[model samples]
Target: MKIMIMRHGEAEATALSDGQRPLTEEGINEVTQVAELVAEEYVVSKIIASPLLRAQQTASLMATGLNLPAVDTLTELAPEHKPESVLKALASEEAEVLLLVSHMPLVDQLAGWLLEGSRMSPIAFPTATVAVLHTDHLAAGVAELERVFLAPS
Candidate 1:
């Protein structure tokens, strides 16, 4: 199985209204370009995204490029959620190729936990970066980081 973890695109610092944050034009363009890049190289089967607007929007763009359905929002992968739960949830899912769009520390921590069974500090997942992991199984600590694709900011 191949799991691709993507950080959300650039977003405004504050929302116009409560819970109304959306991606800026540049963010949308950046994510779209990143999605095209992913499509050119990978065969994505399923997409999962955080509930946040930026993450969801990024996932949607990727899904569109892949001709797949819109992402299924996984609350466990939300920005404020714990990394353990996200890993647990991922371990339970059955997909050959899974794409996840989420926040920074969470994405970095998840990758570190999968790769080393522990968290690595100073997580630095720039906007629209995708980290790919390969594994025979989805259990915790089973994955190996294959590569990281960084989209131009």
Candidate 2:
């Protein structure tokens, strides 16, 4: 299975509420570019995102580029969610190619859990970045980073 983990694009700092923060104009453009790149480079079967506006917006762009529906927002994929739960959800999902759009610590933690069984320091996603993980089995705890895509600033 191939999992594409993406961090949401840049968003305004002052939001109505933290979770409701929308992407900035720069963020929109950056994510759009990355989405187009993904569309040309990969075959994504499913897109999943956190309920936060920034993540939803980012996922929406990628979904459109891939000709897939908008991601199903799941609280379990939100920031602060337990890593084990995220892993469980991924394991249970039937999709062979999955795209996940989420926040920083969660994205970083998820990557670590899938790769090394521990939390990792956040790797700045820089507006629109996608990290691809290739694994022999989705349910098994073994995967390797295939590549990382960083949108040009």
**Over all chains combined, what TM-score does candidate 1 have?**
0.90
Model 2 Cα shift for residue 62 (angstroms)? 0.8
Clashing pairs in 2: none
lDDT of 2 by residue, 1-153 (tens): 888889999899988798999999989998988988888889999999999999999999889888996578778788889767887776677787899999878888877777776677234466678989888765324778887888876
Predict model 1's lDDT versus the native: 0.81
lDDT of 1 by residue, 1-153 (tens): 898988988888799752356778888888888888888888898999998888888888889988897679898878778778887777678888899898877898887777766767233588888888898865557688877777775
lDDT at 59 for candidate 2? 91
- Give all candidates' CA lDDT scores: 0.81, 0.83
Q: Against the true structure, what is each candidate's TM-score?
A: 0.90, 0.92
Most TM-score-accurate candidate: 2
Residue 76's lDDT in candidate 1: 83
